[model samples]
Target: MIRLAGLAVAPWLLWPLLGAFIGLMPAPAGADDTASSPATLLPAPVAPVPPLLDRQQVDAAIGRLDGIVDAAMAKTAIPGVAVAVVYKDEILYAKGFGLREVGQPEPVDMDTVFLLASVSKPITSTILARLVGDKLFDWDDPVRGHDPSFALSDPYVTENATFADLLSHRSGLNTGAGDLLEDLGFDRETILSRLDQQPLDPFRSTYHYSNYGYTAGAVAAAKAAGEPFEDIAERVLFEPLGMSRSSYRHTDYLGHANRARIHVRVGDPAERRWEARYDRMPDAQAPAGGASGSISDLARYLRLQLRDGSFEGEPIVDAGALATTHLPHIAGRLPADPTERAGFYGLGWNVGYDDLGRVTLGHSGAFVLGTSTAILLLPGEELGIAAITNGEPIGVPEAIGSTFMDIAQHGEQTVDWLSFIGGFFAHEFAVDPAGPDYAEPPASAEPPRADDAYAGTYDNSYYGPLVVETEGGALSMKLGPADAPKRFPLTPYDGDVFTFEPIGENAAPLSAAQFRTGDDGGIASVTLEFYDRTGLGTFTRN
Candidate 1:
């Protein structure tokens, strides 16, 4: 893990197996080709040819999965899990394990809802393909074609940016650019408006994992479809796929049942305890990571993709367009490894292969305090597995997906997957929440000035404005728009620098807060940093 601004940056933390799958990247060759040159694409996807298993074999596999899951839960103290596996055209198995909420007897079920996190990217990609099939806009069309105001700090790339560029994460923006605004309660349109102010990377020269880029793509798609993003998804994707329980809006989950509660294990191993989190993500970035659904609902989605964009024999999007979605749009950098080639970033999915040279595609989604989701699609074996857990991730979903693929592809005897994969992600199990490596504010510091001294609003060009107020003799900060936006408690650490106490486990772990002083010795600006990346912005006193 790379440390950025005193925080451990694990951009690849969620994509632990991506490097191993680099060998399975597929080539494309088909009609309805949307690429600038289809001939340059990889060969067509290989159809799944794994041997079919008898009910006895299937039952045993399910039993093994149950044992692995149960062991993982007990060892990690994970609260609950929902898993669904599809082989060929059949729902091979779907089951829930453990409790939806720790200490509660209710078991997680097929319909239990978990946040899809970045897993929403692939769904967003499919939605883009559906719109392209409808002739809403060409995949390569300039992003500004749909939203004339769309832009980056660099005018050249901004003028040349395309929908595919945004979706493929080649838009030259830093990873998670414009995310601070989302975390601060800014709405989608506002986030889009402030995007130009965020920092950029080398133009199309690196694989910067970005959620804001997808959010921008969604904004453009919304413009092209002449409808809200959620509405477009509902009409074009969910309604047709029969994803009755899936929704991008938080309001839709208000009274929903069997919803997974976000749980965090705090304290040391001896005294660690699971705690529920109440923090929520901003709805504006729904296109990026704001999706919630069950394993059953996601199984239908996987089935659609497995059938090459057809749903129940009806064409949702043309096969060629779907194929184009899976093709790598840009080179993705991975550490130099003798075993795997440099990876590539596709539209939403990471395009690559397994060691056996079989095509593999997948994505992982992580909710900071709650759940982790993994979806692996092995087109070569007509197999797909989606695993979601209600507790903090301990490689449950990835291990399950990998084990399912191994069973279908290799037909091997059951392996101790819990111990095998858990060993790879041991740091996850050994997370010391109270360790100094965390971004918590130091307890030995006091403010250099009175609390009211720093009370005021600060502004940024691209991230919008932030308000710092003194409430109850303590300093608090709020960002963007909200009825009563959540506040971060500020504790002074060094001269003119402070740290914020996180509100909840899911809330952004803001590390250091520095107040730039004017020549007059007054606070002139403020800057904040998070574990995910660098300092957000220099918010000047308004």
Candidate 2:
């Protein structure tokens, strides 16, 4: 049977499969507007429902939870981990393991807050669902109706795209459209405003996971509710569910005393070790990844999900509105083998069906700098598990959740989940070796022109101004808003081609900056390879 892994935020490696899973094929050509409705998007079960594991069987799996987590921690060496399992309305299991940070004595506990990363998407969807229940907005409502600032390059899409379209990654903004801007220190408003500069795919028919696209949908909901997105989330979901430790603001997470420090892997690959760092500040994409909460808080949230948006017997959101978040809305991955089942993405979750024909709702969040989190819900069994770690993603969280689900469903893990899922994460995040080695110039590399000849101020409508200037003895480029431009020192590669290491979450080790001369033999423009994903990286000399 086909199984699924978690959703990753990395644009180049968004969807990674673990097993076979079916996704609804996009509507045929000239289909009606209703073709992408939730009713029409849900995939048929692959097989008849087998007899589910009995309560005793599930409890037995829970009994082995400590051992499973312990084993996973030992294998991954994740600095900190907190896991919660919910069955029916009860938190069947909740625990923490390892130190909160390397060389620190503070042990991770149930209350230790960690960044949720992309897992925040699912939480954001929950907030929208509650808003939908209040009649503040509908999933199908055009985002522009609420927030006129939300727009895309395609006029038709900007005017017609619905909240559902954005949440399901079908608005056609290319994968990670605004992420580069976010990495370049752009604010949320600036990123959203510049989305019109991004190229589009085929509107609703294409699935391209975009963090800013998802954030745009949340922003529209906040506008409709007449409040900030964070406030709406608190009022509609967090506060109602009693998740006091949960918050979408990065500042709140910083103020918490028991929060886990985010850590990244460093040093040699074979001998890599975790180091605490505060480099990833996700406030710009708050709705997409800026969330921090304890496992105890997530357990409460999970209970509401399994209970159809009810908290402690009280209905927090309409069941129908909440259910829509779990239904397949678009095909996430098209398998190379036609016979293989494809994967689907729901409103904010990765939707798949397990071997038992039970619907599985899952999402994996990662900040390449640090933090990895995963959540898996079996709505059919009313069972779910959430795992969070304060370390760079190496599949610790996905492995933990997948292992728990496997044990619960089949009485034992069917595979070495850590190795299987971790291998995929490793491959996805692995550095590509095919690119030009900028560090080693060609033997006959031609010398660049005089520093003054290539130094000048260039401009691009989308990225603003980029200043190439001669530093002490070398060339450097500064780009961003006028007040706070990021600077990168350029190294001569070959002829007019110079290279610099781009920084931030989406940066590559090295990127080539090629300068082209006009008819007058004066440098006319420079194209930054790293920022050219959507054809917006070229800066023409002013």
lDDT accuracy of residue 373 in candidate 1 = 78
Tens-place lDDT digits, model 2, residues 401-483: 77777677668877777887788878888788887567788899999998988898998989888999987888999987677
Determine which window of 10 residues in candidate 2 has minimal summed lDDT: 19-28
List the candidate 2 regions with Cα displacement exceeding 4 Å: 2-51
Expressed as tens digits, the lDDT of each residue in 310-374 for candidate 1 is 97889998777777777767777664544335456778787764544455677877665666778
Stretches of candidate 1 off by over 4 Å are: 1-34, 37-63, 413-447, 450-453, 467-469, 475-478, 502-510, 529-536
lDDT, residue 57, model 2: 76
Error of 1 at 108 (Å): 1.7
TM-scores for every candidate against the unseen true structure: 0.85, 0.92
